[model samples]
Target: MKTVAICSGKGGVGKTALACSIAAIIAGDQKRVLLFDGNLGLPNCDVYCGIEVGCTLGHIVRDGRELRDAVVPTKAGFDLISGGSGWKELAQLEGAEIDALVGDLMVLADTYDHVLIDCAPGVGNRVFPFLRASQGLMVVTTSEAASLMDGYALLKNAWDVNPSLTAGLVVNHVGSPAQGRGVASEVQGIVGQFLSQELEYWGSIRHDSLVARACAERRIFASAFPTAGPSQDLVDAANAIMGLGVEAEATEEISMLGRIKSVFGKKTEDSEDKAA
Candidate 1:
């Protein structure tokens, strides 16, 4: 399965909402999509979709429950592995524990066409494992200056962990497509010039009040307000993602456990270098 991680450096950028809408759009197209909420500390995919989650990854980690048992069905036609909110222990997971959890989640690879991970905001430990494990990474941001900076930071952090890693950008809460394109271009230019990295523009989500209303109602905006501007934007973005043509051979080369260990080793080497 092709896995994608939806993340941002700052919160309140509509990351989760966009993730849900994109998953809904993909599922609507008859593709088997699994929405795995990887936002451990403040999981809200279930809340955003208005579905009551019976269990979560928290249960699997804390209570020794089976991973499949935590799979919760959603009205969006995609199964959800809810990241139940307020699981503090998740923020403190070590490398081995992360490897175990990811290894279990990997078993679903053969079962779905896409597995979208709604990762936590920021470039913390909780977010890296998901980012490293995924085939594609989509960084969400707004038109604001602070948001762009943080989004760039997220991109830079990801590249620092895996320099070969490439990511796409989604400008949310924009007034128009031109505005979104402008913002994406600025960020892309900066990253390419300074960090020598490349970022793809995956399209943007317009600032539609209907999206907030749908979220307030705990529903997928693509379903609740399909005709809305933001909804259409999400659909377009999802289509772009599908067209990304992620290489199956490259995806197969990514072992979550190995990636985690490699990242740890890199960090350790960097630390020792600085100490010298």
Candidate 2:
């Protein structure tokens, strides 16, 4: 299973949008996907995905619910686990508690092929723990200088906390094609040169009025519109994630009959027949 985090140093960069899009595409492809709305204090995932949550990550931790019970299903065929709603509770955990919390989250990995975490903006405690649990990190940024700088800062933080963490870049709000390429090049250069990390360009979401429109309607634009450029770009980004091409190989190939036989081979009667 691959644990991918969609995070940004600053908020309002369409991080949740990118995360939800990835979750939708992964689920659509028949892959079991779970998305955690790690942005606890300013939680909007439930609203964006049109899900009314009975339980959130904050509730599970503070209210004494099991982690399994915190996961809520959305209309897009994916699961969502949310974070704390109250700002005071967001940074209210100690180091040990954070460690224990992440340990519990690992159990879900066994049941999912992809777990996409939508981390909160800025370098907060909430962001790092999620980053630690993740196998790969994708930083969402815009064309603004401050956003680019924050993206680098987040990359630096990730490296400081975990040296082996692989990172990806998803440029959002590209007002123009030229500006998009420049943003990608600038961010990728900083990561490659200063951090000594290869930044995976997961593609960009062009500036679209539909995005804001959907947010106003409190729904994922991708699922609602389906044909919007931003929505299409998000699907391409999800494909890029799954197509990362991690190595997994079986020892040998089985024939069609052998494959069918293998399914039934687990039966006690089949075992007896083979012995006989």
Please give the CA lDDT of all the candidate structures.
0.85, 0.79
Instruction: State how far residue 80 of model 2 sits from its true place (Å).
Output: 0.7
Tell me which residue pairs clash in candidate 2.
Answer: none
Write the residue-wise lDDT of candidate 2 on 124-208 in tens digits.
6767888888878888998888998998999899878877777878889987656777778888887789778888777788899
The lDDT, on a scale of 0 to 1, for candidate 1 is 0.85
Query: After superposition on all CA atoms, what RMSD does each candidate show versus the true structure?
Result: 12.0, 5.6
Off by over 4 Å in 1: 246-276
Residue-pair clashes per prediction, in order, are 0, 0
Q: Judging by lDDT against the true structure, name the best candidate.
A: 1
TM-score of each: 0.86, 0.85
